[model samples]
Target: MANVNTAPSWHAPHAGFIRVLVGLFTVAALVVIAMTLAYPGPDPHTIVLVSAGISLVALNIVAFTLPWGRLPRRHTFWLALAQLVITILLAGTLYQTNNAIPLLALIPVLWIAFQLDWPHTIAIIVALGLGCIAFWLIVEPMPSRPRVIVAISVFYFVVASLAILTQANADALRRSRAIAEEAWRSQQDALASAESNAAVMRAIAHGVDAAVFFASQDRSSTFANQRAQELGRRMGVSAQDPTWAGHEVYGPDRVTPIPPEDQLLPRALQGEYATESLQWVGEPGAQHAVSVSSLPAVTEAGEQVGAVIVAHDITNLVEALHAAESFSATVAHELRTPLTSIVGYLDLLETDDLDETGREFLRRAQQGVTSLSAKLRELLEPFEVAGASPTFSFIDVVDLLRRRVNHWRESAGTRGIVIEGPDGSSRLQVPLDRELAERMVDAVLSNAVKFSASGGRIEVAVDTHENSARITVTDHGLGMTREETRHAFERFYRAPTAIRRALPGFGLGLATALSIAQAHGGTIRLESAAGAGTTAIVEISLTQVGVAARGSS
Candidate 1:
């Protein structure tokens, strides 16, 4: 990106004007001082000479301050305004002091006209001329006042007229050059685009074991390679019609007509692009999936010229995706039945009359059921995400967090773990989904409480700011190594330490939490060391009103 550089190339030409101004003023001041010392009295001619030199120096200074050559645009406008006031003052003084030097005022007038557009040029000219006439009336002139006045007035009028003409001609020339350059560039761009497109089409045709062709506005084939013609013959298409019509094409297997849906050649002739990823039925049970793309060819003026279509066979990819989805659905369904029965029996056993040993056995059975249910849910969750609608609403994040913490506190307490949270002073409102956000927070905090050693603390803090909200959960217990932390959020990726420590978790907590955070336009990040502790931070924006209300609530 091109920004206003603080320091530009030192060799820039605009500095020349400033240097000239400085030199002019320095030389003029020295000469005026020397001459004043030489004369030592009030002589009109000498005074006029000194005044003229001073005015010349001021003119140069005004020019220097203007956006004369290569200054940045913003600074140019500001400096130009300052220069304008100085120019008006100097011009008025020169006109009043000596009629002969009034012609010098025309220089600034012409300069203004050339540099800026018409409105400002006209305004400056009018102001300078009116001010000079008014000053002439006020100041008593020399013996040749009428002639001098007439001469100066004519000079200004003639110069102003010539300046306007010159400006118009220069503008016209610039516009003509710009238009010509734009046309030339467009031609070059179009040629490059055409060459690129041809190369891409050729490469695509070569990569696939199929043919591709493009047609032009004149109903003539613009591009068709040897492979396309060969494919035409194999598909029983007449090679004569270079842009394939809906004619029968004989492949190695059998005779096949281009499907009614894929009449790309006909559409191209009518100046419309067509696309199809279709399977052509050949023999009784023969079909092959072919991916086809079509695009309308247009000119620089946006005139539709023709169309190009490329077809590539992708039957294998389509089949593989279908098979995968089917297998996943079947596996998930099969596991659900056995899981339901086991959970149901555990529920019954836990509720029935039982002794101490029986109660302990039932509790273990229920824990197993809970773990199985979680694994089953994890396996099925991704499929639901595909169809899940993105819905957002205001939610009491603190209240929700509290409920989840309370629910998990009992389980963590059994292992002698402590969970800490925000005090009553902290704000805990955020915009998010109730169920998804709750589940996500629950998963992360649960893992924190689970992994922490007996009596170790799991701290939860909710920090709100003007633009965002942060939820941090820190656990002081067995922390992960670098490699483990890197892949900690990956599904089913249990760390060696975590697995060896007899912690019962499916390792989907981080992954699910990450998904939920992302859904709410938030992120979950972790900071941890091997033995130090782990901190999980969830940052979500408070840009939306719903989010703000929820967070505030």
Candidate 2:
């Protein structure tokens, strides 16, 4: 911000006001000259002096109004001095007649003081004072009175003081006015910027579907968006009280009161960052599950100022989880009772009394029962998969995969789907949990058969790459879009295409397969496109904790 004011250099402090004052002085001088010219019996000397005074008045007008900046800097002092000389001579000539004519000297002295610096101003004042005194002694008869002498001295002193004081006050006032105007403009700019930022923040806080709020350290000031205000009222916070308190907050259990020290807002204000601290607010019958997260507001110097808190309504998610737990409990109790009775009966029917074919069928029935038990256990494992560790056994991966493919063939054939396999009889030994590996394979193979069109082909392969085993299962059938494929392995996330086609599935197949693969220190991924097909690859690491090295087959 440099001052870029383009006003001309000739522009004076209060230029218009100065012009008005000078104009008045010119008019007054003209009236005096006119009065002198109109005298019925004017002397020739007086007549000549009146004409000279008129000419000087006209010159004074031009000098005062001209743009002094058009001339050189030196010309200013000379021109100002010339104007003062004219004023002095004209006043001296007319003083004997008008007596009051000496007052006109004030015009030039004041102008010089206003337009020039102190040194030049002092010179002009001294010259005007000497000229007036000289005219008083030489131009007219002296009234030898002590009162007249004292009055002249006092008048000159007062005039000089008035000029100096007026100029100083004028300069100070101009400077103050300029500063005030600049400050006003700066305040306007700051106010507009602050308002614009507030508008953007309002949109962001309200645009999102979450409850957002802010508060000062002492809880004396606060801000909350529309949703937060609604949530606040619902949480039993009074409209008049501070948003920080006036409500009872409970933990996720919806029964235990959350102590003030453990609460999200209190902790954050105390300079802690707390995230996803679940709270149940409002009365028991009308409570809502809110996941509140908080961060301490701090200055650049790391001094804690206040707190910022965001809350999300997790009522649906919490309710869904509760329902799932209850449903699992009910299903487990009902199914296990009948399953136990069936196992007891099967054990009582001894295969020792049966023929070879009967014993073979009996053996198959027992295996099917064992598989059902394994399926139940797999279903429950997902609830605790993140912390579950696999118990590894040195097992042949190829054999296990081949057996799974063989077992799935009959079921796949009912839809005319044919299964392929890893080429040749090769043993690829890897450390793995045997039953979990079989379950992972079964999940992938089942999905391949279920989604494939009639007579569609499937390929299963297990290969040794470096020190790891890779299992790939590919099917030529309906596939999925990129968006759908991204989330297809999330539990219960059936693809839109699958759901539209009325496919029978819980969308749990790939999720289960993925969990088991990761448990074995492996990864499962799919490459898919709509109407093209899908290829699922499961890769397992050869190394495992506490397991000795096994050779590749």
Candidate 3:
């Protein structure tokens, strides 16, 4: 892993003031040294005075090179103290020779004022004052030059005071800058959050089929997605408006206009949630399932604001439902007559049968006709009541499967297909309608027999547990592809291979079988791969309610 740097970069200190002080001191020290060297006094203190001047020059040079202001507070204080002591010692030596170098004391005072806090600066000032007093007593200047000493001391005090004021102003500016930077960062974060929220809203608006509108508190629209815009054009008005072109908006009946108070947008503005299916009457009629939900656009405290309106076009779904209902009715009307006639003829033949075998054949034919009529009725019933519940009974589900498998065996044997069932006592008690269970088993068995090739084997098994019973059917047949198996239970869906082979089926057997299993709180799973055969498993929960109907006869 690459190393990450987390530490803040070091900031160099401001050196403008320190540089000016160093330059001034250097010039003053050189001039003083030249004057002392040119004019030696009677005591001839030339070497001592020149040495002090050279030391002052060297000290200022060090001060100019180092970043004294950037050092720690205590280190800076000690450095300033060293400069002050050196300056005091040099000036005291000059005064001992009567060289009149009191102005040098001002340098240390200025350094202290700029670098140290108020308390330390004040302490240094007092110490410098005492040193001046000692100079006045010990080096007692001549009566004519007393004014010079007083004037120089007063000048040093004034310069130190000015430095303190400058430091105070600098501190204030630094604080102000820090606050401004914090506010700028906060504003940037807020802008980023707003942009993220806008992106999410845009994605939601464009991704769904629903038409969305964002409006202000004054009921003016601020935004509408592509779908909403299209919907508005279709309705012959702008999407911003709840109604357009004086067009009447009617309820589900499409006759009477809905009350204005009950309208979706109007109710939402009143802080009420509203949803309704409405029809727009125009040259070409349109239908919408509209919902309006309001959320107050408030600050931290609660307040009411405008609402968001979502309109969905469910016209295609509604039309498809109507078409399916019509088709079911037509199928029932067409099949009823023929099926009734067949059942009547079979019933009559049962009475006129002569031999035992003939009688048995007639009985089987009548039963088959009866089962077909019942299936037709069950299929048509759903078009009227979509979720109508099934009638149930207490019966042995395993026995029901065995009987249906046996019925299909003779037909399958004719094509050289073998039907195998579970060995020994195929009796598992469960609460389910005997006729419906039989129908489900017969449907699955029929599909297996139809799809299996000659000499193929169809294996059937039933296993019972404490909570549920399972029936499995495995067939070695012309299997289905992945896509075919996925849609195998869809109504009227036949596998491509089956269609190509011209298999005899209406494609409703597995669909009806799946429906029956689900209605009894069960599920059917089909697994198959191309050219690898198929396995069908049906599981029914035995503890489902509404199983208290009459027992199977």
Candidate 4:
């Protein structure tokens, strides 16, 4: 059979004392009852004395029990002291009557040893010994029997002392273990809470639309989230493919690796910190903008463990910043025109007149004023569309182009630039904002006339394509370079060649034409080369004519 280990439940430090007291009293009571029944003494009331002594001992045990689960220091002290006093009294009384039991006298001493400290135990033992000596001297029937009583008392004290000391030591150990177990459980709970909070923080961080990376002590990427993977793709870095880990960034591909001394992971591992925003060019044709931040994960002792990197995409932010800068430049360019006109008019009016040179200067001043007025009108056109959405209406492309061409025909005639268009040919209906579409065609034709040399030929071609109508304005004049064609749609972007030869004209006509085409879900494209002719093509959809009205109802 396997051995089973068991222990007493709910044992106070003084429980052993209480049990011993109860047992001694019960023994005394049973002895008294037995004597009453079997011996039938002359004064059977003698058994009553024994019973009373037992009752007193029982009372002491009850007192000890009353204090349990209460304050330990006072309860233990009082319990041990009362038990000692009651045991000594009862045992001394019985001994004086020639019925002294050394075992009974030893009860309080053993209890004191178990419940209280060693000094109290020793005091209890001394008191019990003194009471035993007094019992022998005053109440023992035979003087010669004193030695035997004393010897028995000494033996009882020794046995009780050992038992109490052992019990006290065991209780102390149990208390210590209880404290340790409580501390350990508290630590475990703390660890679990910390881990839970960390998980929640990590989840929230990764859920954001920014790249997140965690690198190990060795600087290898341990965790790369979705955003991180996407950024890596743009930067020509891959989690699956081995490469220089520190090179993972948002911008263009780096032709050379970052210096080891300046690397984020290495510095983080070395207990240093670094983070900054950088612009880089990716492989061949990559242009990505990013802001990167890195920090070190440190231990409790402040030792660096790992590193975390967060990369945020700032491409849109970069573009918006650029747009604001461009707008500022355009505003300056627009203001220059009006300021130039005022300056020229002031100069011509102040100068002495009545000569050919002065007359020519006056003519130039008038032209400058006219150019400034036109520039202000173009600058205000975009804001007009801001409050009013485009209204698309069906109109014949040939008629529209011809009407706008004829409107500018007298101006073209004076400039010796022939504005021949539509050739009175086939009609093609196109979806467009009627006013905006005509203005777009007029702007292109006007530019063709303005830029063309005297006697230059300008052609307006209106035709139908796969799913849309196209308006083409071709001019045999000074052409634009490839770079100019690319930026032709930018407001205030005048071609270098055109700016060198033309009068004062803000480069907003083509940009406005392109914006109108886009508002109608259409497009405008330019084809031109230096020394070669230029063509401006505008295309609009048929559905754009009535889609807004259909959606409104």
Candidate 5:
């Protein structure tokens, strides 16, 4: 860096200031010459020369006062040349009177060289040389005048050349230094910006409701956010420690500690990315159920440099899942036991000594019992997510959608709502378990109607394909926020709006729909915003359904 204080008080003169000073010097010379001629009664040659000299000095002063701003910058070159001519004429006169050496002729040459470029400087130098030679030839001189003039000219030429060259290098150096300084300032700004961004990221991590920790590959350094540090303290160790203190990390059972070798940080540092490694942290009362995900920090060249772990407290989510499962198991168990007895009674009631109507009623009752039993077992099972996928069969999905839309019309009519869909004989055969597929379709439709405002409208479209199908259900409903949409398919995860409205639901509808779709190798997504409405997009694959159907069969 350059020090600003190095510049001296006596700075170099500006070109305009130098011109004014030159004018003033001429005025002083004219005053002294006029005073000296006052006593000599002034000879005619000398008198005419002094008069010409006075006019020249007056012209120079007039130039010094010229409104240079209105003039072209190039006019300065002409001005300096004009002064050079006047100086030479006056110098020749002054020489005649007192044999004075004319040093004033060098001023304009230095002025041009200092303020202008190489071309102007060269012109000034050449003009000065020609003027000096002409002056010598015009004046009466004795004894080897040519040799004397040549030696004096050579000396002035060397000094002027060196001075002009030095000025050019100084200008170039100043320009280069300015560019370097600008580049340095830009680099400094970029570095400061990077640090500011880094600080913001750290603050976000610290404020988040999760534990974030990182460890270097060499295990020489570690970074941890507030939550991570808090968790570490509860577990009797610092988060910076690569290894946990004792067996503080418990498995999903929450009773047994995980092995040291199976720990998250250790494995992650060794290039293992452990995703969704749910574990219990801290002791008993203070224990938190956390879903830990460890990612190996890798370079573009595929080398792992270190590892980072992010863990969120999912204690409430886990507890809710368990409670819902327990309730489902209890309901299924109670209903199944009573249904078995009802089936036995229906079988015993069947007899030949019955009227045709009575026998038909008995058969219908038995069929109802069988169907109800199967539905309870499949839908209410606590471990349904882990169970085998239902069997698939060829079904007209378009017809199914048309019928479903009609079925919901009655329920919608109760709230002055309208449900619309395909009406004509549109046939699309897709390999899907009819009951399971219907359940999934019903779940989305139910939510559409249940969450919709009174007098809302729903548009259902069934797009047909040879090997797939897409069902889009758009409803003008009390829509969900981004957070709600993200966790909409989480089992027993209800939106805050639904809870606030006291909506009657177990929050299992969309969750069940998601499971069924995924089991059939399909995709389901919801698009919604608060008070805007919801659009549920469901796409099912015929190929995946075909494979599942064949495998089950």
Candidate 6:
């Protein structure tokens, strides 16, 4: 719909050509005045002719003062045409005197050729040729009229043709220069973008703390950042090797070599993602824990072109966990010794004769000491069971729940808190660690009794589903907000209400319960709202129980 080859409209004669035309007009006017004065023509006729020549010169001078170079193309064309008409009239008047004034027509013809394109210049040239013939026949009665007309027309045509060619060449040269400049600018932009990308890559290689490694698709070439090189050296790997795909990697034991296929880099190259922590022993017997992650590198087209591996040192975290476990064991042992002594003293005082009030105080002291000892043992169970596999045994689900519930009945009764269990008893056998299962139930029941108000009721229910057992404990007490329930199982987290009520707890009950449930491939769900009640449901899979039964058979 648009013309693609349209020419620019602003092309016009250069300012130098306009100045030359003005100078030529001034010289022609002076020559006319001098010739008239020397020839001594009729006074009135000479005055009229001299005044007309001088006025044409004055007009040319004024045109020079105008900003011709900045004028629009159409306006500039009309200005050149006006000057040409004036030149024609002056030349016709002088030629009537039989002088060589016809040559002055060349000025207007040249100006038109330089200022206009081929179409406009040719039209003006034809008009000037007609004017030359008319002047020769009508305004002047000179001999050899046809020869004069032919000479003037031939000269103007030649000059106009030359000017058209020159203007076209200049326009083409300018257009070529503009295109070259645009190409140069694009090249500069591309080069700058490449430099910026390289700088960012270099900064990341040196600035990041994590070890970074990159490998080509075929594993023939590899790149390792500074941190990665250090990690490789510590692991006895050749950091500078180009082909390290099949290199041996050590496991946590530091003695057995891990399979090449199982290593992070190899797995990643196979389009698999991997993240794991491995322990290594250095020359000085220092333990180092390194976490490695590997992922396939994908391009914009979604093609897996290579892989990236990142490794991080976690030695401090591992050491801290070990130290914390040791501290917990030491504290539990130190506290148990004094608590056992207090319980023994209370037992001895009970046997001796004393007043009823004193005996009641002794009983309360014994109960407090016993409860403290139990909690201390429960708190240490996680550390104690670390790395120890559970010993599975078939146990009656109903009987286990009944025995644990009865153990808490006395304590609940003290506050008029009633605990209700399932109505009927059935032999629902489940394979689990008996002691661990009892401990899990104890945590749930303890929280129920501790939070229940006087005369409140705690309900316990057990049911067997397809391949699992579900245990639900509901308590009508000062419940928790939704936000508090979300974090109820987090270690050391106590609800705001529990803290305000000054409840005696270490905030470890629910967390310990969750750990125990997860060990048996189970999950625990809590439901509660402020001012309502709280319900805890624990689900444990029975697939392992069935497997154990078949193995025994």
C-alpha RMSD by candidate, in order? 22.0, 12.4, 13.0, 22.7, 12.2, 10.9
Candidate 5 residue lDDT tens string, 226-294: 898877775556445556443577888888888877878667877778788888888877788889899
Candidate 2 lDDT, tens digit per residue, 58-152? 76687677765455433455554655665566666665556666666676677667655678778877887887576556454566567656756
Candidate 3, residues 1-553: lDDT per residue as tens digits? 1122222222344466667767787887787788787877776457876886888789778877886557555455554555565555556556645445666666666566655566777767776767666555535545537675775577556756665775576467556756766666666666667777888989989898788866667765467789877765654454445532224455666566666666555666666665544555333354553333344455466654556767777677556755865786688878989998998787677665369999888878878888778667755643333354566767776667677778988999999999998765656667776666776888888888888999999999988666678899999998888899888986667888888999866577788788888878888989888887888999888776234443322
TM-score of predicted model 4? 0.39
Candidate 1 vs. true structure, TM-score: 0.39
Consecutive 10-residue window with the lowest summed lDDT within model 5: 2-11
TM-scores of the candidates in the order shown: 0.39, 0.50, 0.46, 0.39, 0.53, 0.53
Q: What would the per-residue lDDT of candidate 1 be over residues 318-382, giving only the tens digit for each residue?
A: 67855765665578779899989888877777755799899998888888778777767766664
Question: What does the lDDT come to for candidate 6?
Answer: 0.73
Query: Which ten contiguous residues of candidate 6 have the minimum total lDDT?
Result: 1-10
Best by lDDT: 5
Candidate 1 global lDDT: 0.65
User: What lDDT score is found at residue 516 in candidate 6?
Assistant: 81
Better model by TM-score: candidate 2 vs candidate 5: 5
Model 4 score (lDDT): 0.66
Residue pairs clashing, model 1 = 234-250, 235-249, 235-250, 236-249, 236-250, 429-551, 429-552, 430-550, 430-551, 431-547
Error of 3 at 112 (Å): 20
Instruction: After the best TM-score superposition of candidate 3, give how far the Cα of residue 70 lies from its true spot, in angstroms.
Output: 18
Alpha carbon lDDT at 270, candidate 1? 69
Question: How are the candidates ranked when ordered by lDDT, highest leading?
Answer: 5, 2, 6, 3, 4, 1
Residue 168 error, candidate 5, Å: 1.0
**Superposed model 4: Cα runs more than 4 Å off:** 1-45, 53-61, 64-67, 71-73, 76-82, 85-101, 104-107, 117-123, 138-142, 149-153, 156-274, 277-290, 300-302, 321-553
- Cα distance off (Å), candidate 3, residue 380: 4.1
